[model samples]
Target: MVTTKRNKEFCQKVRLKSTQVFIVAGTCLITVLVTLLCIGFMTRYEVDNEVANVADVDYWKDKVASSQKIWYDKGIDELNEALRTPRGPIYPKNLRIFLIQGVDGRDLAAYRFSGKDLSNGNTNFVWDKFPHFARLKNTCSQQFPCPISSVAKSLWTGIPLDKIPEAQPDCGNLVNETETPFSVLRQAQLAGLLTGFVTTQRFTGSTGAALGNTNSNYECDERMPLGSLKSGCQDIARQLITGETGKSLNVIIGGGRQMLSSLVPKSISDPVDELLCESNDGRNLLKEWRNQKLKESKVKPIKFELVQRADELESLNASNFDFLFGVMANGDLSGNSNAPSLKLMVEKSLQVLKKKNQGYLLIVEQFIQSGMNKRKELQLLNETLTNLKREEDTLTLVLLTNAIYPKPILDMSEETETINQLSETFNEAEFQIQETLYQMPSESLLFAIGPKSSIFHGVQKETFIAHAVSHVLSKSSPKT
Candidate 1:
């Protein structure tokens, strides 16, 4: 009887232990499964956040669907046809082009630099200095009073703002390859000719953007809406680094350094700008530009320089470098002593471009406000023109894109006199301006020299300028 009791107790203990072991194993397995499920949820949440940041396709689809028909110039249809014509294969050697902007006939006459009064029905100003230059007329200003329209009209496409349909806000001033031809700078680049863009305006401004960028509604990346960015519409500054024409440029000198860098930990040498340089997209474009150049250098030896200060620009020996990029300010060049003058920029550009044997196309724009600033720019322009080598193979075009402002009080500060004595005649003279609103259309002028310049005579449509340039460029046989 005692033996039987002991065996039963032992069996009971064994059963109890077996139950505990099964419970522990099941609990452990359940815990492991729950942990794996939690990990999966966390990974899914991270992916969801990323997609949410860019917004869902349905969200963007609604935005695009709601977008109304944007208005543009009526002549765009015809201009598109003209642009669609295939470019010629020929690229002539020793054919150089210089397109200079902001040489207003009215301003020239008002300042008495032309020795003739253009306001007094005197068409003689066109023939006074350079007999070959044509005084082209821009009729788009008669309709749209904005300087923006003037640039849009004279640009590669030569089409003005919307006129046919009711004008809409935030319309016009956009370029697309489907509607317009390649810019002169792009054409020159494709032709294997050196190309440069020098401006006192922001490098991504309408004038500068027109040289290389296409289809961008905004000049900077931050200004673009998420919908626009997602739709593959790149901003102007981004295009400058990635675009075919922009990357191939031999020389680029102007302002807008902040556009190429991040907002935080501002780039070295970036000036404090009135507008914030908010590139919240987490991209450092300046670094990207450098990386691109470095990668290209691996394939072929290329000497390039990226400078920021006036002293750095001045110190550069133009012939030693194949590419030069100088961003002197955050905005349009300020009167900061650290910034190089327009004349200095032009001088350096000419020197660098002239080194190429195939020829070059240099476009220089002086977009400045204030009478004093205009005077200083004009003085520098005059000096540069006077110093030009006047090569027979070079075609120089001075286009007066008049962006009029209210006449300011002509105050002569001692600081102004320090520029040089060459501006003395222009300083003491009384400055006169036609009283008009800021956007009102004013007469524009064009001066030309070199081959085929005689063909441009009398007043012509703004579109005629692009056509004429194309014609001249096409006349040459392909480079051997």
Candidate 2:
């Protein structure tokens, strides 16, 4: 009996020890798992809070939806389909179009000095020049509205009072005749490729003046004889399309309706109508262009059609004729803020230009820098570039502001963070500032994505663009 009791007690003690050991092991395992889970949740919370701080997720979601709406509403997908394929060549048998945005020079130079690869870095240099803040109020005095001459003096000459270069007498004795794109256009016309100038700004704004070479001193002055009046600019527009120059412009679409109307209308005309069409001399600029294009061309009398509505643009036949001038709005086609989108303009222009077997040159200008409209304008431009890339042989050039404003930097930072978050679960390293800072120079960016695009990666001046364009077009020249 004594032996049996001892054995039983020993067995009981062994079982108790084993149970304690098992309990300790199980407790340790549960504690470890719980600790790991807590750590994971804390990490996730930190990440979420940080992301929320950097970006307004809800706002961007809404913005993306809005952008998508705009894209769909304008038939952007259809336009992209059309531009993706190459239209048979126009002249030299090769076609190239230049899309330029006139940002100021200093801003362009700054970005040029900054390295291109820094775009991915945290520096946000490009966005710094023109900070995408709230819109600016019209601050210029009514008596001294901001003129292109004043802006050009600050941008080009760097002196408000300094005289701009005068047009050479050999180039038809035009004033303010600096070496400009107009000279290049004249050369193009001489080469017989059906040159055309299109812009959203008035037909005589800074950009318009550059293309038509109307007057140097009066870049924005629409006055006739001197400005948009009976003088050289109007003459150039008329001659290019209709006059003895014989180089009939295939396209001349823009807003200068006032320049086109006669000073005095028929007796039935309203006083306001007469005033809108009034000029120093009694002449109509729009009528002159219509008449000239409608007139038989010496080489090939091109049929001319003027479209005033978006519906008109959609209904037009693509293979109609050699010359087409589409003017959608009065002064400066409505900007993206108030006008039909750039994608609409680009698709329409392509449709019209595609008629030529001798490849055509189309210039699409978005005046984004004009008062209170930069953000909307640039957004539309970005969309245009993104969509345009769908087409082959289409080289798109985006010209930025001459200087980078500090305001856009904050938004850029926000954008960078958002992209990073979407790309990964968690990124701890702060973005490098030096690399980003390097891209802050105002130098212009020539973002080219087409044949020979590699050549445009480095720092280049504006004049180089014309040369590059000419060279590309020359490649398609008929074998002599």
Candidate 3:
């Protein structure tokens, strides 16, 4: 009996020791797991904070400003309307309008002059007119003249403004055929809506060439020179505007009249008034297009018209032509502020293009939004124009509001003081002081309005605009 009791006690002790060991081991395992989990959570938090910080930097601030303006001004309303409105898949036969070439979209958001305001004896501000920088009291100081070029470069690349190339120094031979914009245009042409190119720059300039045939060289080809290099503008006007392209172009309009005159010009002293006498090339261009139309009786004949003034454009019969060209100015058409309004241009183009039951593609550009002030104007203009298009079955797309302007940050103290000052000073200020206090950072903005604008918002590359246009056009085409 004594031996049995001793053995049982020994066994009990052994069991106690093992239990303690197990408990200690389990606690250690739990501790390790908790530590690992804490570390992972901390890492994720840090990463998220870093991302937010980067977004707050100058570049993203500009983007946010421009994008928010569109959203606040018209995008949201347009989106709601689109969602509520029933849409038939875009018909291939509908006319296509394009706005390209030049700095556009900066001040487009600010051009919000209401008709009621205009009519109500409030001439405090002109709604559609471009505002000069000198008129802005809040304009940046001399120390920081608005960085227009820097902003333009940044917007084009979607990078920080400082990172953009200062100049495009001759990057060797330009393999123009391979550029993405040209490829997009080629695809557009192949899809079958009548193709047209209009611009204020040389036909060979980056934007202009994107629409026309690609060449290994940038200079107008040997076939089309009038005077010297300085005089090449005339050559561009005559040759490309009226010159033969193997393909039947539905429309061609823009400046560069001096380029069209030949060595044989005699009577007209004013180079602008000189008529493009029928050169072999001009006759051939006309003959070839005529023959093509005759051969394919189903196709519409290409009608050509040169418009120097807005009044001239207004007089044309909308029903008469399938193709129309108007060169409004000698050089780049007047900046949006100084030039005839884009509203006017859009109206005229639509009139001509819509005449065809078969549909048409028209590209209209307002090329003055390169600077900060102009960008703001472009933005406002876009909003106004978009509102105007409410009744039409149109899709308007805006590209590259991406230019980066220097950050305009008002610290919390300044913002508070400004608000207080405004409240005390103005008895009946219609505009909110806070709205003016929170100035936009200069950044590029891109958006699309009309039927399918929602497809574009958020961050995207420039080429995507080209892709979207093609995709939209393709969906709308008759073959599809």
All candidates: CA RMSD in angstroms?
28.2, 20.6, 16.6
Best candidate, TM-score:
1
Clashes found in each candidate (C-alpha, N, C closer than 3 A): 1, 54, 39
**Local accuracy by lDDT, each model:** 0.63, 0.47, 0.44
Report the number of backbone clashes for model 3: 39
lDDT of 2 by residue, 1-480 (tens): 999999999999999999999999999999999999998888689677552322222223355676566545445434443334234333234344434454544433343333567433323232222211111111111112234343322222222222345433233555333443244444456555555666665555555545554433332223323333433344333333333322355665665444444342322221222222233445555666666555556545556677755667667774575666665554455422234456766666666666434555666665644354444445555566556534444444444543323323322343344346543523333454433443333334445544454455455433456666666656643333
TM-score of 2: 0.52
TM-score of each: 0.64, 0.52, 0.48
Tens-digit per-residue lDDT, 221-291, candidate 1:
67787766665666778888888878899899998766776553334445556564445576666777778
From the highest TM-score down, the ranking of the candidates is: 1, 2, 3
Quality of model 3 by C-alpha lDDT: 0.44
Using lDDT as the measure, what is the rank order of every candidate, best first? 1, 2, 3
Q: Which parts of model 3 are misplaced by more than 4 Å?
A: 1-86, 90-183, 198-205, 216-247, 262-302, 335-341, 355-357, 369-393, 400-443
**102, model 1: CA deviation in Å?**
5.5
lDDT per residue as tens, model 3, 1-480: 999999999999999999999999999999999999998888688677542232222323355677466445444443343334335444334434334333323333343344445432322222222111111011111114454533322222233434433322233333342442233444555676555555434334444443443322222324443333333332222334333331445655554333332232222222332232223333223334444555555554455554555678777664466556554543344421233445555665665555443445565444443444554545544553654544345555444332233444333233344456775645545465434533433223454444555565555444445556667677655453
What TM-score does prediction 3 earn? Answer: 0.48
